[model samples]
Target: MNLFIGLLNMAIEKDNDRALYLVQKAEVLAEIELFYLLPHQRRWRSWFPEVIYCRVDVEKTRIYIKEAIKKGKWNMDDWPEMKHKILKLLSIDDAIIDLAV
Candidate 1:
């Protein structure tokens, strides 16, 4: 995650709030991913460290992702390949996968 934001920071103009905020959102989504995927993990030093212990509703998460995607002005084609694979592996619908990625 550090490397990703570091590269993005270096590639974009310095002190860019929009880019940084987008990265921050991405990091949160990543945390959400781990929260659902990992069953035995304890904690992570994030905004919500006790996410693993807290309830993680899959259907709610999916709806959350859908809502987020709808609200953002994101480039539809700029999704990472790993996102594609992850959503596909989880059996996400193709149309929703397009937005989630």
Candidate 2:
């Protein structure tokens, strides 16, 4: 609870109104995540603390990465490698194991 409050305070300080309001909502969710969910049973495992908790389908995650790369104007050919890194960040158990490094 304290951690969530502190995080909310920091977010509110640094972000704009919309982001601040979202952080307030996130704080409520964080409270539930921290107290209601047990350690092993928690979904997503706090994999990306900077990311808000939500249902992120693997395909959508891939698409988002591709879109972000395009937006950033980076010309990288390693689609497979980038996909693997995004999946790993999400802590998805089915992510390609051989790509681990």
Candidate 3:
């Protein structure tokens, strides 16, 4: 976590567009993993609710989504649609969305 933040900070400090792009990509991937794990990880879920939420009606939503995706629930082309959902779930506010884009 510290390493990720350090790289992101360096990208911003240097104003390097390519590095910024890579950092953003890394951020998205990390957040997806967080989203997938948060449900089962009680400590993480308790720690992060103030920071973000997801579109779910009940528990195990993340697990179900992961299973579905693994079982051909979405095609490669469908990921573009889901990407925005993942971003929204990971974001704490409008500022986060702005930074991500």
The candidate that wins on lDDT is: 2
**How do the predictions measure up, each by TM-score?**
0.30, 0.27, 0.27
Backbone collisions counted per model: 0, 0, 0
Report the number of the highest-TM-score candidate. Answer: 1
**lDDT, model 2, position 20:** 53
lDDT of 3 by residue, 1-101 (tens): 67666767777677866535565755655675666565566356454443433334434554554444556563435566575575356442334334433
lDDT scores for all predictions?
Answer: 0.57, 0.59, 0.53
Q: In model 3, how large is the Cα lDDT of residue 15?
A: 84
Candidate 1 residue runs with Cα over 4 Å from true position: 1-55, 73-79, 97-101
Candidate scoring better on TM-score of 1 and 3: 1
Cα lDDT, model 2, residue 76? 39
Per-residue CA lDDT of model 1 for 2-35, tens digit only, reads: 9656656665566665545566656656656576
Q: Arrange candidates by TM-score, highest first: which order?
A: 1, 2, 3
Clashing pairs in 1: none
